[model samples]
Target: MRTLKQALLALLVLSSAVADLPTEMPIPEAFIGSPVGTASL
Candidate 1:
């Protein structure tokens, strides 16, 4: 169907756009509470 083809095309464009985004996300400040050298388990 024409709608199905349109949907697939839109999905392809969206996926390609998402793939171009920077992969490395910065850690949020709230999650970085531990002091530099210490490990919490």
Candidate 2:
């Protein structure tokens, strides 16, 4: 019914909106480096 159609429409809109987001998020500088004595994996 009507509710199912509305749910599908809402999902379509949400998915489209999410698809427009940036594919590559920038990494924060703090996580990119470690202190002089510490080892990074």
Candidate 3:
């Protein structure tokens, strides 16, 4: 149970990081060519 809680917390932190990515940039056509946008597709 303790390990599960830790895993959940880690997931929350990682989700926040992913959420921050789009907010950090416009993600325009230029970004689409990058790995991040391509992976999203």
Candidate 4:
């Protein structure tokens, strides 16, 4: 149980760290051409 908790904590920290990194992937032209608020929920 303790190991499971530790693993979850580590995963959470790593996920947050990765989320903070800048996205290197290119944005599709369709997404760029789409007007703002067109896809908003």
Best by lDDT: 3
Candidate 3 pairs with clashing backbones:
none
Model 3 residue runs over 4 Å out of place are 23-41
lDDT of each: 0.46, 0.46, 0.58, 0.48
Number of the candidate with higher TM-score, 1 or 3:
1
Task: Mark the 10 consecutive residues where model 4 has the least summed lDDT.
Answer: 32-41
Better structure of 1 and 3 per lDDT: 3
What is the lDDT for 37 in model 4? 17
Question: Model 4 segments beyond 4 Å from truth?
Answer: 25-41
Off by over 4 Å in 2: 24-41
| Number of residue pairs clashing in candidate 3, backbone atoms closer than 3 angstroms, sequence gap of 3 or more or interchain | 0
Candidate 2: Cα lDDT at 17:
51
Q: Which candidate model has the greater lDDT, 3 or 4?
A: 3
**Candidate 3 lDDT score at position 38:** 60
lDDT of 2 by residue, 1-41 (tens): 99688667655654565466455733223223323112232
Worst 10 residues of 3 by lDDT: 30-39
Which pairs clash in model 2? Answer: none
lDDT of 4 by residue, 1-41 (tens): 99688667655655565566457733343234333212321
Candidate 3 per-residue C-alpha lDDT over 1-41 given as tens digits, one digit per residue, 9 for 90 to 100: 99688667655655565666667565465346554446546
lDDT assessment of candidate 1: 0.46
Lowest lDDT 10-residue stretch of candidate 1 = 32-41
lDDT score, residue 20, model 1? Answer: 60
